[model samples]
Target: MSFDLHGRTQRLELSDQNLRAFEAVVLESTPEGIVLSKSAFYPGGGGQPADHGVLLWQGVETRIVGVRKGDDLHLIPAEGDPIPPVGTVVEAAVADERRSALMRTHSGLHVLCGVVFRDYGSLVTGGNMEPFSARMDFNLPEVPPGFKEAVEDACNAEITADRRIDVRVLPRSEAFAIPDIIRTATNLVPDDVEDVRVVDIVGLDTQADGGTHVASTKQIGRIKVAKIESKGRGFRRLRITISD
Candidate 1:
């Protein structure tokens, strides 16, 4: 299959890394697997989870159980298969169900960020995501007594609004012009990259990001502010759970 550089536009397409195997002509050989002209697989970056699945080549199914990045390229398993010379094609498929769940969880966190920033002006300090749950750290002296409920209400309101989630790659200059772009946690964006992919929650939130997400907030379902913990010194942690 031809590789699409613009995979974020179609979340379903983005999940195909484990579903469809393609003939990947090797571009460069390494102890690791070869690089192809187009790869559905993601080389894992940001705080998002890595893409895990399988790689098939020359009738051998090598488990691509992990993904790592090197100089902007992905290092996958070569197993025992003879590395095809440059110009060879390989098939790749992504673990769809796992990826989809991550998409939901990632988008849910963005919604939460919007609610927290809009309501309390808190800044996100750090966060991570699993298939069904996510946690975000914020720099707040103390969560208001009713902050949890308020955040829940706001998130659901945005979900109910069915806001569209737009993903786009922008030139560095253009991206810096947007107000929300400046609010992202520093480590979330790679400073060396000249272009940045931005995720925009229409009328809700926006930030520079590389993680995959659902097309609309409505797809995130009902989100629960499961727990809040004191992180001390003007910081708090918020845990969120989403029902399948």
Candidate 2:
């Protein structure tokens, strides 16, 4: 994929997500959508959903219904809307309520992963999320008795601990030197990715992650292990929900 310098979208949200809205000049305009010089909209990946918000230009505003990452980050407008022209300056805002819920829930899942690994010595095999709901799979022979209750209790305990969550970008060499503290497969990272983004639950867990997260475990509110399912041999899936 190739794009001119003007078509590049600088991702502001990656540095500070609290910056919900910002002004950026339009870099590209097509029938599909527009790309901004910089963006706060998350072109969702890593099991997290994309962000939806609004784009404001002049006195006209249109809802951003979807986002996709390609040669440039494209902010898709609602159907029948006019694409902002190149060189137009616009304001972009993410859906705060939805973003917050997703952030908290994502952090909560990490807490669950940490708790399960600490207690059962199981690594996370897979996970996915939606706003306040999430599920994680582990390489376990079976769902142990009282496992749901124990995970719920343990996750809440960590939330009470209010562990700080930190995000850091490290050189691949430096990251690989950390002795692989992640509870999931690290081989999924491409060898060419020289810089790895790491999300650390301070004292609990750390992994190469690209999703958004809350500042602390306490912000995750309460987590409930809603269900646990046995998925074939050596697999167990746990579903959870978040509430205040």
Candidate 3:
């Protein structure tokens, strides 16, 4: 399975983060999920949640609540919604506001990851995000003087710099050669996966990722380090909120 194709569906979101709507043929359909001939719906992964949207067909609207990933990408519909019949041509749209917010949040997390690693030399243990808020856990035995305030300041500064965020697909050998990919908290791409999609915050950080992101750091808006909590044994969880 290449990075842009999931089972039989051509995954459109990877190539165009800005695409909100597209027409697709229904390859398979059930009350639980619908598989499309092509889709721009981002199947959630890498700490970012899946997208929510709707499929319009024959005057019927099927609300997609989440995506179920497998051999094929299955779009989960809102319970009680009508399922499109197989072969039905439908107009699908990804909720723009929610997706746009997520793009900023995801990029903000990358900026946070890049900054923390550069300044503190800490490794991320885990992280998760919602529209404009996120929490990233790092392994830091000791919080240095003014770490929280310092981090927030640096993050905003990077935003001011307006660094470019670039995404590209590379072969596994070439991608793993980049040192930063090894430092990421999660490098779980399977051995069988030949093509790796890399997200780069120019001059900042790079990771093998498969999630949608904003085009640049400044697009992330402002990142406020809200709280820092100790999760015991050298683990620190930092909560953040994104704002315009």
Candidate 4:
């Protein structure tokens, strides 16, 4: 499912790429964690990992070890941590360095997917990433000779194009209308979902994605194809890493 923020409880789900910190009210608190009225933490989905950060209240710093419900629930592991009462206001911040790196890495994978599909007519079957590296699997009988070199050149060309990256939340009906939306695991979105979040590398690629991304291709800097592995029977996995 696209990580579109649910507006049900008035707690704004923070932007996956842009927001670094937020102020929120504690709607509820328990040993499990605290629910914020709003949050900037990315809950980790769509090939990206959950955000790491801290919540500050009354001079105590509580590390946010994990998150749930798309970042609505900021889970703080109990190590004698102070639990603020309901309605308490707190300052929430995500680790900026980590968030930024993840943003670039996530967008890089999208670029890889876009380039491969555009050039080879392949489709992404699955993918995963760390802060600065990722791997994407595609349905292909076998990678051609010099395929790695070809991909690296094409991807770099697009990156040099400095295309702008756009993110939008659209009505599910409108989102489904786009041809590219169906290319990337569109079925994974639930039928009950009324809205979808889209990430677009303008004129290059677009998909229903729910992760952080850089503002433009230029911000992604250099990318290297680290390795390729055969997953057997018409499947190949390409690994990539962001470099200097």
Candidate 5:
């Protein structure tokens, strides 16, 4: 399998975050899922959700409600939606409103992750996101005074700085060589994986990530630290939202 292939499908979204529409041939088709030769729909991971869109073929429209990852990337069609037959060349359009919001939200989380680690020296324990909101867990036993306001200020400062956000894939050995590639409390990357996709917030932060992000920190808009909670010993949760 080539580096660009996830199963039998060529994952176009990996190289092009701004891609929203593409044409592809159905290699396999069913109500459950459809496999295409090439697709730009992000089959989400790493705290991001899969993209939703529609497939157009022969004047019929089948809505893609979700994506299922397997040997091949499976575009999960809406229940009872018409499934394109194998070999059908369909025009696919990713739901821009959803994907764009997600791109901003995901990048916002990375900015938050970078700021927290840089200022507090806490490692991320876990994280998740939706269209414009997210929460991240950090391993910090003590809640510093004014921690919430401080993080929000720092995050927006970086966003205002308009730092570049770059994504690249490198061989496994080269990626881990960076000191902060794995900012998580524990390494989450699989040992069998031979390559690593890195998401770098210029000089602020770097991590081995496999999710879509904006072109720069400004594209993330303003990140609002909505709330903070103590889940357990050394576990602190920060809830955040993204706004224009």
Candidate 6:
């Protein structure tokens, strides 16, 4: 399997430490670990967290401590073991718990965006995600009183609804047809990119994205809109946390 440019959504099902033995073609080999033709790893981008996993070569396991994207390539950690030649097969596994936490956090941010956009017609200006927390900036004059609570409640309601999260790639023209998608705070779809990957939260949210997420809102567990702050004129920040 070639490396998927479009991100994956099944976090828990991802093999964590066991993918070291699978076959993979080395696309690029450097002092850093090689980039394989097909990798389950995601190089961090668009404010989302980077993937941490293990790459197996022979009987040796090397930790993938960091991932950086180059022009059409991903730069991984340096190999401490013998470097595999190009076309060599290797196994890759993502850190399961970290990936799962990020999935929940990423999905929770989407839910928050959906609620804020629907209720206030606000657009998200920026955002960042960690393992268990994330924050989004919105182009709103000010966060309304009790807005945080309202958003939390709205997110929980959707999670309880167990809405399915769908991800797929679409042609640029096809993706641009949706008004709601075009109105996202960030221009997630790169202009140079030919195809756009979209994440749809059933009837609640839809936007162009290339981040990992859960298959259903119910997998997000309990979400708390922990804080809301004013960034500047017409911009508000919402901080969120997901708990057990």
**Across residues 121-186, which tens digit of lDDT does each residue of candidate 1 receive?**
888888888888989999888767788998999999999999999988788789888886755445
Total clashing pairs in model 3:
0
Reference-based lDDT, residue 76, model 3: 99
Quote each prediction's TM-score.
Answer: 0.83, 0.94, 0.98, 0.91, 0.98, 0.87
What lDDT score belongs to each candidate, Candidate 1 first? 0.72, 0.84, 0.94, 0.80, 0.93, 0.75
Give the Cα-based TM-score of candidate 2 against the true structure. Answer: 0.94
For candidate 3, the 10 contiguous residues with the lowest summed lDDT are 180-189
Candidate 6: which stretches are off by over 4 Å? Answer: 1-22, 78-82
Q: Largest lDDT belongs to which candidate?
A: 3
lDDT of 4 by residue, 169-211 (tens): 8999999999868555336787887888888999999988777
Model 6 / residue 59 / CA error / Å: 1.1
Rank list by TM-score: 5, 3, 2, 4, 6, 1
Model 1 regions lying over 4 Å from their true place: 1-23, 28-34, 78-88, 185-191
Q: What's the residue-level lDDT of 54 in candidate 1?
A: 63
- Residue 31's lDDT within candidate 2 is 64
Query: Which lDDT tens digits does candidate 3 get at residues 1-244?
Result: 6679999899999999999999999999998889999999999988999999999999999999999999899999999999999999999999999999999999999999999999989888888999999999999999999999999999999999999999999999999999878555656788899999999999998988899999999999999999999999999999999999
Which stretches of candidate 4 lie above 4 Å from their native place?
Answer: 1-4, 7-16, 70-74, 78-80
lDDT by residue for model 6 over 1-244, one digit each (tens)?
1124422212222323123234566677776646666666656766787778777777877677777665444536655655666666777777888877888888898988888889899988888999989998899996667887888999899999999998877788898887788546556666777677788999999988877888899999989988888998888888999987
- Looking at model 4, report the run of 10 residues with the lowest lDDT sum: 5-14
Q: Give candidate 5 regions above 4 Å deviation.
A: none
lDDT value for model 2: 0.84
Error of 5 at 210 (Å): 0.7
Ranking by lDDT: 3, 5, 2, 4, 6, 1
RMSD of each: 4.5, 2.7, 0.9, 2.5, 0.8, 4.2
